[model samples]
Target: MNNSLQDTLALVGRILLAWLFVPAGFGKIAGFSGAVGYATSVGLPLPEVGVAVGLLIELVGGLMLLVGFMTRPAAVLLAFFTLVASFFFHAYWSLPADQAMMQQLMFNKNIAISGGLLAFAAFGAGRWSLDAKRQRV
Candidate 1:
């Protein structure tokens, strides 16, 4: 594809992907205790600390991805986070008989999101990104 088309696609992908995390982070922030409880239920070591760190990564990293600032690094971090979440929280590999259909759906979605983040890491922020401007200087 031409440069302009590539740039537009990248920007749209970044926005859509980043928006996915923003509400999640905001939900954690809005329901701090519920987030803590959920984290604990998931057997996350140091539930409070994990929730804090996860929220920051989701919120700040999502914003950075959206703006294309530090896009490559942000994408890498988010991708890693997605992988971990998929395995641990989403239980992508575990086919528990008791798991609800929604749980299975979440697992698949997390895996897909991880793939998208990996794509961003590989293809980069494209022409319209702050990273591009920085690269030119």
Candidate 2:
């Protein structure tokens, strides 16, 4: 593809990726107690802290991705975060058969999301990014 098309795709990709995380971060903030409770239920130690960390990653890291600022590091960080969350929250193997199906689906989805994030990390945010702008300076 041409550079212009490639740049547009990178911008769209960042927006799409940010859509999943930014809203989730806001939702966690809006339902702070519930998020903390969910973390506790999932047996994560320091549940409150975990929730706080998750929201920060989802929000801050997500914004960085949306703006294509430090895109590589942000994508890698988000990918790692997604993988960790999948293991903890979507542990399908530990669930009953009925619950396992949905959890398995979620786990696989997260895995796919992580793969996309990794692609961004490997390639970059393209010419539409702050990273690219900074490079020109």
Every candidate's lDDT? 0.87, 0.96
Residue-level lDDT of model 1, residues 1-137, one tens digit each, is 99999999999999999998878889889998999998888788898998888899899999999999998889999988877776668663455667756677888888888889988988899989999989999
- In TM-score terms, candidate 1 sits at 0.91
Query: Which residue pairs in candidate 1 have backbone atoms (N, alpha carbon, C) closer than 3 angstroms, thus clashing?
Result: none
Cα displacement (angstroms), candidate 1, residue 97, comes to: 3.0
Across 9-99, the per-residue lDDT of candidate 2 in tens digits comes to 9999999999999999999999999999999999988999999999999999999999999999999999999999999899999999989
My TM-score estimates for the predictions, one after another, are: 0.91, 0.98
